[model samples]
Structure formats: structure tokens, C-alpha cells
Target chain A: DAGVTQSPTHLIKTRGQHVTLRCSPISGHKSVSWYQQVLGQGPQFIFQYYEKEERGRGNFPDRFSARQFPNYSSELNVNALLLGDSALYLCASSAYGGSGNTIYFGEGSWLTVV
Target chain B: QKEVEQDPGPLSVPEGAIVSLNCTYSNSAFQYFMWYRQYSRKGPELLMYTYSSGNKEDGRFTAQVDKSSKYISLFIRDSQPSDSATYLCAQRLVGNEKLTFGTGTRLTIIP
Candidate 1:
């Protein structure tokens, strides 16, 4: 079966610009989560959607938002981007929305803000 | 203190040697422990998952967890060059979906 897949493998944007990254979860998976990884750092959780509802959110600012579709795909959007926003955005999926389920991650969308 | 603490090692070892990677957590409430291996510019891949305070071995890799000391470890035996990558330790609470991760330790296996 195909693993979690993300789109816009890479992109660059200027400060104050907006960008959207996409993700398609593995077949039969219903939960999707987003994380941001800065250089030399581990990934930080951004948002988690289960059954198309927001289940959890991280400490990120209002500029970051995400939503999941009925098919379990997800989109991560960043508004008024800042240089600090430059990082790899990762999407993870699991069979369900609860704990104890194994989560699989995508290759990630690399975003650069100038 | 950070929720999870890991030694950011650029640890280099010769091939066929035993490699030990470790992490410490401040919270005893973390019920699930996991190790992830990530290559350069790639997402992390789950390596081992452990729930209790014991050792779980898979092929050449062993994951050990100690709740009393709040320490977790991953051991790689007969390491290979293909094992060169960053090792990350993560933990999650019983009902929480968010995984708190430590600063990863970079490992390089020499040929």
C-alpha cells in the first residue's frame, strides 16, 4: 500500500506571502497530522485532524492552520510567512484518531521564506 | 527543562560495532516511547516502539525503556553504513496525540 504522500516537495515564498501544502494519507487511514522541522531540530507538532475534525493543536501561531478532507487528505496553510517559517513541513497519518495507532510520515514539503 | 532531552551526537562508529543512542524525559506521564531514524532531508521513519519499562529487540535493534529513571535507549548491533542517520527519541502521553521529541542524535557508521 502507498504510504503517506505530500505535495509541493519544495517551494519558496517571500515574507508576508501565503503558502499551502497538501498531503494524501495512506489508504484506509483516517487521521492526519502536521509537523514542522527546523534545521538541526526535531519536528514540532502543528495540528492534528481526525475524522475531519480538529483533534489537537500545537503552540504555533494563528498564521498556521490546517484542515482535513473527507477522504482523509489534509492541507496546511501558512499566512503572512516570516523567515522563521522556513522549514520542512511533514504530514503523518494513522489508521485512526486515537493513541497507540502507528503513524506513518510523508517525505515532507520543504518551504523557504525569504 | 525540555520535556525530552537527548545528546545531539555526531557520533561516529566503525562498522560492525555496537551503537547505543539514548534520551531522557522529564515527565513520567509519557506512556509511549518510540525511536525514529531519519535521513538527510527526509521525514523520520519509526524504528521501535515500546510501552513498558523493559527491553524489546527486533533483529539487530533493541529498544529499552526505564520508567523509574525516565530514560529510554536504542541499541544497534553490528551497525552498518546504511544505518548512518539521525536518531530521534519521542514520547507521548496515554491520551495525547502530540509526540514530544528530543533533539535528534546524528550517527555515522564508518565503512
Candidate 2:
């Protein structure tokens, strides 16, 4: 089966610009989550949407937002990007929205801000 | 202090040797633990997942969790060159979907 997939495998932006990253979950998955991974660091959770509803959010600022569609795909939006926002944005999916379910991740969208 | 701590080792090991990776966390609320392996520029692939404490083994990989000490470990037996990559530890609390992750440990299996 196809794993979680992300779009815009790589992107380059400048300070004060906005960027949007997309993700499509595994066919049978119902929950989608977003994470930010800085170079050499682990992925930090950003947002999770289960059945198109916001389920959880991480420590990211208000500039980072996400939404899941009816088809279980998700999009992460960042406004007024900063150099610190340069990182790999990962998307994960699970068959269920619970903690017990296994989460699968995508290759991620690499974003660079100058 | 960071919630999770892991040594970002550029650890080198010979093929067929035992490889062990570990992480420590400060949060007691985290009840679900998982280990993921990632190749360069790729997404993490789940290698092990466990809840509560104790140990679970899958094929050549073993996962050990010590909730009392807030420590978790992943051990690979008869490691092969294909196992060379970054290993990451992740945790989530019951009823929560957000995961907290430790900085990955890079391993190199010398053939």
C-alpha cells in the first residue's frame, strides 16, 4: 500500500513570505498529523486532525496552522515565515486517531527560508 | 530541561555486532513509546512500538521500556549494513495524539 505522501518535496521562501505544504494519508488511514523537523533534530509535532477535526496541537506559534480534508488529506500553512522555520515538514497518518495505532510518515517537505 | 534526551551519536559499529540505542525523558505522562528508523532525506519508518513498561521483541529488533526511570531502549541483534541510519525515539501520552521525539542517533554499520 502507498504510505503517507507529501507534496512540494522541497521549497524555498524568503522572510515574511507564506508557504503551504500538503499531505495525503495512506488509503485506509483516518487521522493526519503534521510535524516540523529541524536539521539534525527530531520531529516536533505541530498539529493532528482526526476525521477532519482538530485533535491536538504542539508548541508551535500561531503562524503555523493545519487542516484535514474529508478525504483524510492535510495541509500545513505558515505565515510570515522566518529563518527559524527552515526545516523538513513531515506528515503522518494512522488508521485510528488513538495513541495505540501505528503512525506512518511521509518523506516530508523540505522548506528553506532566507 | 528538554522532555526527551538522546545522544546524537554518529555511532559506528561493525556488521553482525549488537547495536543499542536509548532515550530518557522527563515526562511521566508519556505512556506510549515508539522507535523509528530513517535513511537520509527520508521519512521515519516505525521499527517498534510499546506501551507501559517491559520489553518487546520483533525479529532482530528489541524494545525495552522502563517507565519508572523514564527510559526507553532499542536493541538490534546481528546488525547488518542496511540498518545504518538515524534512530529516533518518540513518546505520546494516553488520549493524546501529539508525539514528543528525541533527537535521532545516527548509526553506521561498517561492512
Candidate 3:
């Protein structure tokens, strides 16, 4: 089966601009989560959506938000971006029932802010 | 201190040698442990996953979790060049799906 997929593989933005990254979860998967990985750092959790409900949220600022669609796809939005917002935004998907409910990740959207 | 700690190694080893990577965590509430392998500029691929504590083996890969010490490890036996990649340890607390990840260790198996 195809794995989770993310769009806008790369993007360039400037300070004060907004950006939206998208993700399509794997077939049969119901949960979608977003993470941000700054250079030299591990992925930091952002938001998780299950069955279209916001399940969990991380310590990100109000500038960051996300939503899951009826199709189990998701979008992560960042407002008034800052240069520090430059990072790889990853999307992961998992099913409710599984041995470990492993969260499989997508290729990620590389966002570069100037 | 971070919830999860791992050495960000650019560790190099000869092919066919044994390799071990580890992570230490401070959150005892974390119950799900996992190891992921990621190539340059790519998303991490799940290599191993375990619950609570104990060891799990798959092919030449072994994952061990020690709840008492809040430690976890991944070992590769008879390692191959293809095994060269960044190994990341991740954990999630019981009843929650959010994961905390290590900084990752980059391994290179030289031929």
C-alpha cells in the first residue's frame, strides 16, 4: 500500500507571510499528526487529529494550527511566520488498532523562511 | 533537560560489524518505544517498536527497552552498508499518541 504523502515538498516564505502544508494519510488510517523538525533537532509534536477531532496539541504558539478533513487528510497552517519557522514539517498517520499503532511519516514539507 | 536524550553520532563502523544505538528518557510515563531509520532528507521509517519493557528481535535487528532505567536500545548484527542511516528513538506515554523523539544518531557502515 502507498504510504502517507505530503504536498509542497518545498516552499520559500518571508517573515509575516503565512503558509499551509498538506498531508494525505495512508489508506485505512484514521489518525494524523504533525511535527516540526528544526535543523540538528528531532521532530517536535505539533498537533494530532483523530476522526476529525483535535486529539492532542503540543507547545507551539497560536500561530500554528491544523485540521483533519473527512477523508482523513490533514493540513497544517502557520500564521505570521518567522525565520525560526524554517524547518521540515512532517505528517504521520496511524490506525487505531495495530500491534504498536506505529505512526508512519511522510516525506515532509521543507519550509524555508527568510 | 529534554524528555528524551540520545547522542547525535556520526558513528562509523566497518561493514559486518555489530552496531548499537541507545536513548535515555526522563519520562517514566512513556510506555511505547520505537526505533526509526531515516536517510538524508527523508522521513523516518519504523524499524522496531515495543511496549513497556523487554526485547524484540526482527531479522538482524534487536530492540530492547528497560523501564526501570528509562532506557532503550537498538542493535544491528552482521550489519550491512544499507544499514547506514540516522537512527532515532521515540516514545509515547500510555493512553496518548503523541511521541517524544531523540535527536537521532547517524551511523555509517563503511565497506
Tens-digit lDDT track of model 2 for B7-78: 999999999999999999999989999999999999999999999999999999999999999999999999
Task: Name the runs in model 2 displaced over 4 angstroms.
Answer: A97-99
TM-score of each candidate structure, all chains considered together: 0.98, 0.96, 0.97
In candidate 3, position A55 carries an lDDT of: 93
**In model 3, where do residues sit more than 4 Å from their true spots?**
none
Q: How close is candidate 1 to the true structure, as a TM-score?
A: 0.98
Question: Candidate 3, which CAPRI tier?
Answer: medium
| Order by DockQ, highest first | 2, 1, 3
DockQ for candidate 3, C-alpha atoms: 0.69
Per-candidate RMSD, Å: 0.9, 1.1, 1.1
lDDT of 3 by residue, A2-113 (tens): 9999999999999999999999999999999999999878899999999999999999999999999999999999999999999999999999674567789999999999
Residue A20 local lDDT, model 2: 93
> Candidate 1, residues B11-43: lDDT per residue as tens digits?
999999999999999998999999999999999
Which of candidates 2 and 3 reaches a greater DockQ?
A: 2
Which 10 successive residues of model 1 chain B have the least lDDT summed? B92-101
Candidate 1 has a DockQ of 0.76
Please, what is the whole-model Cα lDDT of each candidate in the order they appear?
A: 0.94, 0.94, 0.94
The C-alpha stretches of model 1 lying farther than 4 A from their native spots are: A97-99
